[model samples]
Target: MRVLEEIAIEDLGVIRTARVPLASGLTVITGETGAGKTMVLTGLGLLMGGKADPGAVRPGAERAVVEGRWDLTRHPQAAHRVDDAGGAVDDDGTVVVLRTVAQGRSRAHLGGRGVPQGVLAEIAADLVTVHGQSEQLRLRTPGKQRTALDRFAGAAHAGLLADHRAAWAERAGLQSEIDDLTARAAERAREAELLRLGLAEVERVDPQPGEDVELGALVARLGNAEQLRQAAQIAHDAVAGEDMETEGSAVHAVEQARRSLEGAAADDPALGEQAKRLAEAGYLLGDVATELSGYVADLQADPAALEAAHTRLAELGALTRSYGSTVDEALQWASDAGLRLLDLDDGGDRVEAMRARVAELDEQVASLAARLTAGRRSAAVRLSEAVTAELSGLAMRGARLEIEVTDSDPGPAGADHVAFLLVPHPGAPARPLGKGASGGELSRVMLAVEVALATASDDEAGSVLPTFVFDEVDAGVGGRAAVEVGRRLASLARSTQVVVVTHLAQVAAFGDTHLVVTKSAVDGDATVTGVRAVDDDERVRELARMLSGQDESETARQHALELLESSAVGR
Candidate 1:
């Protein structure tokens, strides 16, 4: 989709301020050593959220800045991600990404709005793939080989891989559950026994809600029975005396006053009302005396009953001290403990069920892993043939590429170990990629693998091949081999954008758009480099210089022209 359109870099490494243009074809950058060729890649890396190196800032500069423009006309997914990050896309479907490194701090901006560095990284992942010497080294690992194969396995195989991972995860969870249950078996048993003992004790005592409070009242009353009886008798005597005739008694006194008032009632109406009130008061006093006499009689202390109440109170007290602070609280604890004991009782059954499920998942995972292995093996052959075809065009004629998938212990991805093997010729033993290939061969192999993957990606639904950036892809090659490398890169550019930074003139001659990084010294002290697009004449000079370190050499210029003409013809 030609995702990266251009990049503007400032105060980064040996480059001061330069705007490099890009397009949808093979674009190559060439320069003398230390002419800031790496700075261009560094800038692109920063835009892709690579680690910021404060030391890369030019001397006397406060910070280094790199900004990029990306066109999203065909990348609706990336455009949506930009919106989700609170960034905007230009009217022409372009979004600007900026990265700045100052001192030890780095910041990123997208569409003129501040955003997280990770946002840039996430977007870049689907928009660009950068390969350098370090990336070639990383291709040595089996893990990377497997990943490459999986990417070529298409969507159906990817879905199968996902299902396998899900099954493996479920199995791991069930296994964990079984292990935990086994490890804590004794602990759970002890806990259950303690609960049983507590339940038994509670059942024996049979404490009720508020039972202790009631028992406390009964004990206090029974212990003071004699005093209670005496108090009641004195009150009864004061109210009614031994007989009704007792003069000092409240009932008698009230009755005498009522009679005195009644005798004078005929003299005044007010005296009649007072007499009626005194009569009512005398009746009320007599009722109180009768009730007090009943209470005194009922206050007899039964020692056997008092002793039984005390014993019951003591049992309730023990329960309060152990289980709760009160009888009601103790009862609540028993209720909760009963429910917990029910759960503890089912622990063994739970463990058994979990083990059964784990066995079921183990079978499912094994089947899925076997399928995954089969899928990888099937895809490996196709990928090997495709990459070998690519290698043939990259000047590795008769070199056969083989993808080896071997059995391995089941893992999250699958149960296969993938290796990229190279058979130099028909009789040669198939050796691993990094082990047998030279620098140039490895370079071509990496390129071939990328091309194979990119071609496969074109068929997948909704898949847009990202821009390919290769750093020093022609590390060790010359003559016809180098020309083949250039031709191969140019061919790859037909479907997508290809950017390569190299010192080889042969590789650079094939570029649709050629950029040259030129270095100059100011005041014979400060060094600066600038990247600019070159015309045909300038390109010839640049290629001549790269050929023999002399831009004006007639012989070098002739060879440069011949190389460019040959690459053009191949294109």
Candidate 2:
């Protein structure tokens, strides 16, 4: 809606760093070849969320950073973008946006708040629409054509287009389901048999959780039964046998040692401490032996219970081998199986219903396509006539132009296919805009279509046509025709911003805001980096440099002064 407020660059490749302030009128940029004219556009493109290239950074530099700042709170389209992104307007109703590309990443921000590139791009697309000759190459694609038309005719047709797309997606979804179910029919038969056999196998034994642990405990007790019984019998013999005093049984031996130490205590105190320690060990061993003897008396072996435990463990192993790593996992697999089995059983009915629904969606898409085609075809004649009228003022007086709408298969933009066809002179065959139209002709026709489309879309707000940027818009023309080209540009300027990088004084004379792009050596580097607005007298001097490549000549200066004066361009 407005010219860019600021562009800041730092170590952004060869740029090193530069900042520029822009004005809100026709701004002309004139420079020699390779003066970094393209850099300006590239910078704008990067800030608008274009892909970043680390290679764009200067060698040995750590990063490339380009920052663009815009105050767009007053722009309706910009306000809508802010509202959608959950952002608020500033006190001045100005939202400042900054986009940077550095260190192999591109990021954006709004009102100093970080946002994604997608959000910034949405706002940028509305704020600036660049239309250079190279930029126009993007128009050759049919996708671009459809997008522009939908955007130009957005309000009435965008919702219908969305509906068509949703229906198409639904139809695609059902088709995919049918194909998948058809492929799985045979596989399901085999899996169902395996599943049935597996369920029966696990169900017969009904293995419980921790069955293996219980089996392990039983096995240990059974294997140790004999050794444990023998050990308990020997301990019982030592403590309470009939030959109890032979070699002094455990109780009698400890009593003898205690009495001997009591007598020796008068001779040595160390012997007394040793005897006391031996009496404590003898008491603990006697208690454990008595307990073991009772345990041996009650020990019993049951062959049936051991066999049952082993059998349950084997059943659990089978489930673990087939279903999952653990009982919990096995249960989860069973739950999934139940759900899948239900779907497989009822899949036939579901497939049939989806087929019916897909057919209904197909009908809806076809009907919408028919309506769109009808609307486009009906408007073709009028649109062509309007463009033809605007072209006569550009230079060609009797050129023939026609709008062609060919029917096509359903696409995201409906079934209407539109193209602008032209015959440069009478009796010439009509051809598409790019193939037969000359460069100058192409520019004029583009201007005509844009202006007419803007008028037709007057009811819609926030659709500013793209600014026409041309490096050679005035190429190969002079006299009244050159003047006519300026008129055409001025006509376009009424609704769309026009920026022409040209050598023709006639074209430069048409600017509402004239900027001189000069290349100068800064710190011994040959760089084109200066841009400044010029006034009425200054405009004549710059135009003279462009016209005669000299300013000392009175003749060249007079012509330059006339060109500006005749156009009444008081920049």
Candidate 3:
């Protein structure tokens, strides 16, 4: 069994330093109002990584520290989580948890290593369950009610609920995909048609790479054929004489200079070098003249080829206007459009596939939901009978708890809507927990539910129930009802640890271990609260104080002694 071995609180609230030792069975904490009994629970909460408050620190203290040691031999999941957080478990199967609050900031530590506060919270869920007035109110909510029923059904219902949840999620995803495809059907068709038209236009032209640039140069040359021929003729005459006898040409002038230089070559060797250059220049002039003549012969104005080039350019230009600013850009657009068309065309096939999957998931969800409903309905009958019997012992003799599991639309939790209906008397019509039960009655009913759930856990032999802490579970209850609440808590403690913060003497007498929180002025002015386990005479005095207003009253002492005796017999 999971056990909170001990809790130590330092500088927390009015309690300066208190070490509260816990026990495996029922441990009851009681004190006068404002005497700081709740501080015990506050420390436990902090040790469990509950939200920390700097204001909770005692006056003049820098920080508040709360620590707890737990025996986790029976709680492997909690030990595993601690191990995962880098915490070491002792050979005796104990783990120490620490929480410190300072300057409005909180920190948690597992064993000796510092860890995230959330890590402590995660492990705490497997170690303790704190029930207070708020939890009773939560019992009235439909979600909590459904959860309670599912929990009562145990693993069979839980497995089916898990399966249904998976199927529901799959169905939801497939339906969403189908809806998107259907919604965009018209848009996809439009895109496909546009892509097809663009591809066709690009294919019709079939333009080659860089062809437009080459054609531009060729067209310019053909358009200026006559001017080019005239220019070539002038250049030929300047380089060489039109005929061999022509004067004032470069070839005749160079030859005359070459003859004069050769005559002076015998007297000056530099003149011989000049004559050789002139001879080479005349040869180059002859070659140019011949090439210019050949160019003039070949040059012809061909309007047909020019017209064809212009027509091809116009076609490429038309393609560029709609698809791109250039032929290359248009080609790229066509390539991309072809790929996009394939995806758009596949939308229909994708929608059909998703519809088929959605249909398949729908069947799976229905089947699982049906199983979950059947399981819950069957478990509900047992749960109702069990809780009704518990409520009878808690001072509601004829009250019956009716669990109503009705069919509803499939959801993450399955297709059943469960509600806890209470029949307050034998002949009364069963009504919902909120409308049918009084405050005290509701508290008793919640206690009964807890007892039933704990019993269910015991039968399963799965994970053991965590330590239960109830803050004034007997609120609005008195007389024999208070005693019954105590008896129930004591009975629950037989299977697990139960710590109840209470005020009733009848309840306090039933505790196997009793802690009394007392307030006194210390150091002349400072008020301090402290908790200590009381037994025998001290326990009776404490109970006497609870029964009346004075612990020394003979009448109250007698009642306290009788309560202790009766509690012994009851247990």
Candidate 4:
């Protein structure tokens, strides 16, 4: 893996202004505490798409930005991503990835095409992983642990899981059918009572189309019977006659006028037509009077059964609120509930079927779980042995490691319980690493496990694991142990890029390339710091300072030169 170029970062938390150029091989960065050693890590983390830390924005700085230029031509996994996103590859076969973070906006680009944060994280997961000076807690979470174990187990179990789920679904479906049938066994009696009561209510009311409107009008007429009759008689008198026979008749006047018009029409044709129209109108008015007289005579109140029907309908309206939205909907709900009650009373056969299915599933799951447990047991031993070997190289000499497996009840993944145990020194009782190992010890144990698992994965898959970062793994160790750690890390780098942040001169000497991190005042600001890849002499000076506290001392210089020279010979 190679990082070709980078640009300046300004007012980004503690890093006032920093520019860095990366090299193809290992690069070690060393700096004093608060010299913004972590600022460099922060910048790298952002470029690699880690979570944004708003606090990382320099005090009073409006935004924080990190820009990186990585040459990804030879990166096997990165090549596929570039091609997939339809990005252009340069003539020199290099792909450029840029990440930027502002106050409220974060953006990424590949070959100048805008990409979302998720895409950058995906690519960055393959590029780098930051493990602090302590163990990574996220790796030990149950979900991640289960996933890691499954990934270690490989592809054969994928089909098995699918088949098991399908079988479980079939059994579950059958069980649901049985439950439904059984619940219907005793619902007949209730249903009959419900139907009879409902029918009686409906029958008593005998509601018809437009019944409410018609009955309302009838009730109003009956309630005001005498008043309505008197009004109608008055209307009859005005239209034709209420006493045409007993008094001077209005009809007689109309007939007399018609005679006058008939005489006039003999002289004028228009007056003869008018007289004809008047005679026709006289007959129509007499017919209307006969009808009105009969209608008024029959205006009597009905007080008997209208009240009874209305009361029955009121009961139905109340039932409408409790039972269902409407009469039809209520009837349907009752029907379903009735069936469920019946099944509960007499579904013996279906109940037996349900029991049989549960029993069968229990047996099937137990069998599959046992097999899964065995496979995990075998895998745990191999993983533990490899990790133990790696742990010793990380300076935990004479350490005892174990993978303890316990039988758990059936679960979605499997039935074996797994945990890593450790004893730091000879004759010590083995205990879980979280309980037994110190911070540094736990860090080494985690590294061992990560390195081992990464080695066992497919080439494309392995490249994306958390980078095996050795942060001062050589703090308290040297000689053979320190050398071993370096060798193992170098070996890991062959498969996945390894980045180490260290204070140990021995570890810095082992790096294929060296970098020096420094702090300085920029226009009198305390936060200004910078980091850049160091040339041979600068690297020697840096390593010498780390080795002795006296960077300018001749003895420290000779020692640093010898260490670098020896590392080169060994490589």
Report the number of the highest-TM-score candidate.
1
Clashing pairs in 1: none
- Residues 1-571 of candidate 1 have per-residue lDDT tens digits of 4888999999998888878899789999887788788999999999998889899998889999999999988889999999999999999999999999999899999988898889899998988889898999889889988988888888778888899899888888888878888898899889889888888999999997888898899888899999989989999999999875698999999999999999999999899999999999988998899899889878898899899999998998887798899999988988998998888899889988988888888888889889889889888998899989987877788998899999988899988999999998778999998898888888999888887777675443226677999998999888777888888888889878999998899999999999988788876644545678896889999999999999999999999999889888988
Using TM-score as the yardstick, the better of models 1 and 3 is 1
In angstroms, the error of model 3 at 127 is: 3.1
Reference-based lDDT, residue 83, model 2? 71
Angstrom error of the Cα, residue 278, model 4: value is 16
Q: Identify the leading candidate in terms of lDDT.
A: 1
Q: Considering summed lDDT, which 10 consecutive residues are worst modelled in model 1?
A: 455-464
Clashing pairs in model 2, backbone N/Cα/C closer than 3 A: none
In order, candidate lDDTs are 0.88, 0.68, 0.86, 0.67
lDDT of 4 at 282: 67
- Runs in model 4 lying further than 4 Å from the true structure: 1-13, 19-27, 42-129, 133-150, 157-214, 221-364, 392-400, 409-413, 423-429, 435-440, 457-470, 510-514, 550-555, 565-571
Cα lDDT, model 1, residue 190: 93
Candidate 3 stretches with Cα past 4 Å from truth are 83-92, 111-117, 187-344, 457-462, 524-529
Lowest summed lDDT window (length 10), candidate 4: 459-468
Total clashing pairs in model 2: 0
| Candidates 1 and 2, the one with greater TM-score | 1
TM-score attained by model 2: 0.76
Instruction: Give one digit per residue, the lDDT tens place, for model 4 in 51-139.
Output: 77777788877777777676665666776787677666676666666666667776777766777767767876655656775334654
lDDT by residue for model 3 (1-571), tens: 4479999888888887778889879999988887778888999988887888898988888998898999989888888888999999999999998889898688899988899888888888778989888888898888899888887888767777888888898888888888888998998899899889989999999977777778788888888988998999888878776784489888788889899999999999999999999989888887888898889889889999889988888988898899988778888898899889998998888888888888888888888888888888988899999999998899899999999999877688888888899999999999898788887888899889888888775433235778999997998999989999989998888888999999899888999999887778778544445678899999999999998889999999999999999999999
For model 4 the local lDDT of residue 28 reads 65
lDDT value for model 4 = 0.67
